[model samples]
Target: MLDIAEELNAWAAEGRDFAVATVVAVSGSAPRRPGAALAVDAVGTAVGSVSGGCVESAVYELCRQALADGRPVLERFDDDEDDDDEDGLGTGLTCGGAIDVLVLPVHAAGPVRPVLAAALAATASGGAVALARIVTGPPALLGGALLVHGDGTRHGGFGGHPELDDTVAAEAAAFLDAGRTGTVEVGGRGARCGSPVTVLIESAVPAPRMIVFGAVDFAAALVRVGKFLGFHVTVCDARPVFTTRARFPEADEVVVDWPHRYLERTATDARTVLCVLTHDPKFDVPLLRLALRLPVAYVGAMGSRRTHLDRLERLREAGVTERRLAGLRSPIGLDLGARTPEETALSIAAEIVAARRGGTGVPLTGAHTPIHHDGPLGVGSPA
Candidate 1:
């Protein structure tokens, strides 16, 4: 749902009522992840996707039903084609998997509008926000939602009971801090153990940042690739003429400062990526020294094997430990025999994807690896 937050925001601003169907859980080889959403507005307009195509009509009808009743519903779709006989709606997915979707109606005049507005604003402003909704609970509590900001401020209400609301709020805050999106089950004095309440915590975090150091032609091409991969890309160079926005039109930011100094004062998280396109020692050595020490997801530099060795020695002299040096991906990008700037950018983007998803940068045809490995039911998915 957060993926289409802007569209929802427009509807909310116009005081329009709409319903959303969000994929909350997946099993086996589902097409989409947990946060994938499909929304339908009052006039029957739809946006976003949940199954890529399969089962959309059923989900859309469910959204309309939810909008009409002012209630929420949880619908499950399986890959077994035989199941269609039971539902008569042909809601079975052909992806040979199963998914659970929650159809929730958002009222423009309801208490949740402010929270939705906040979430939409956060997406644009590069802040983090979490939205928690009750998917399985008593009739009065179902579909209840609460919004929590990074600074601990909260809006909206849930569960009707203060104890229940407090418990869910605390849990939502914890997940928000971790930047995780998933479901949590609660049952206790405020909620019965026999009948548990499941809450879906959806976190809308800022796009993972991709800092491209050196505004060369390769960097300009890579900036477009980074943005296409849903990153907030920034191109930086000490040279004012080369670091202009006109050169890298798609970059979210163009910084005209020394690469090392810019990185020293910028903020980064585990999902952030640092790409050093400047192979020169004057720019590469200092910036890499800081990049390697940080906790970002990827740190790669473009250079030949000999250049990499020289850069490594310089970084070592600058006090970067051997263990930290192991994190660097020098001569950055996969070996694809790339010659053009666009081709080189593709290689780098491919390598970045491989690193983030734990792929081996090898052909999958002969490999025995699972086609999907990030889902909850994937072979090595986290417990």
Candidate 2:
């Protein structure tokens, strides 16, 4: 939903009516994740995607239906079978996967508008927000919604059951903290078991950070790629003349500070990526010593084999352990034989993606692996 927030907010400001269809759950080899969404405005314009193109036509029709009915809907699409089109409308999944989608009608003047407005505002402000909807519940409760903001305030009300609403809000907060979008099942009494109520929590947190510890041409190239890949890129260097925003306009920020000191003062999480592009011993040694010990998602250093070896020795002497050093990907990027800065940036970006998505960095043509792997919930084991 955050992916389409800017567009949706524009439509909302224009008082345009629209409907949103979000993939709430998936099984088998689904192409998209839980937060994937598609929205259709009254004029028949659509944005975003739920299942690539397989189930889009069907979901778009559902969105139109939702807008007309002025209510929310929970629709499921499954792998195609001989009898899958029994309904005669031909709305069946062609892909070999199953997905559950929540379709909600939204308008400028409606019960759900506040939630949509709040969601857009949260993403715009770079704050965290989550929306929970009853995907599977009693008829009256189905599609009931709640919005939880970063400051513990809530917007739309949930199902009439107070206990269930409280439980869903708490679960949404936990998922927001973990930066996850998934489903949670709760009982009527807000406990773990009873009459099942599946709440689909869609979250929007600030973009993951990519901090490049060098203000060089390679850093500028990497900043452009990082921004294209949806990261909040920052270029930091102690040399003020080299660390100007004019040099790296694509970067979200240009920090004129020592890499290690700036990193110590910044907020980083498990999704943050630290790139040490400064191959010089004076800058690389201490910056890497600090990065290797942190719990960041990826830490890579740009250097030759000899430089990497010397840096490792310096880090070990600075109290970085063998296990900690293992986290570093020195001589960074894949074996792309990249000579230009743009190509090197591409290789580095590819390696970062492969690491995050558990890819092997091998050519798919000769390898045997799932074409579409499991998503956030870890439903299907990777092949």
Worst 10 residues of 2 by lDDT: 374-383
lDDT of 1 by residue, 188-238 (tens): 334546568888888877778899999999998899889888888999999
Each prediction's TM-score versus the true structure: 0.91, 0.92
Off by over 4 Å in 1: 82-89, 110-114, 188-194, 375-383
Candidate 1 minimal-lDDT segment of 10 residues: 374-383
Tens-digit lDDT track of model 2 for 253-370: 9999988999989998788888899999889888888888788889999999999899899998899999999989989999998999999999999888777777778888978876
lDDT of each: 0.83, 0.83
How far off is residue 331 in model 1, in Å?
1.3
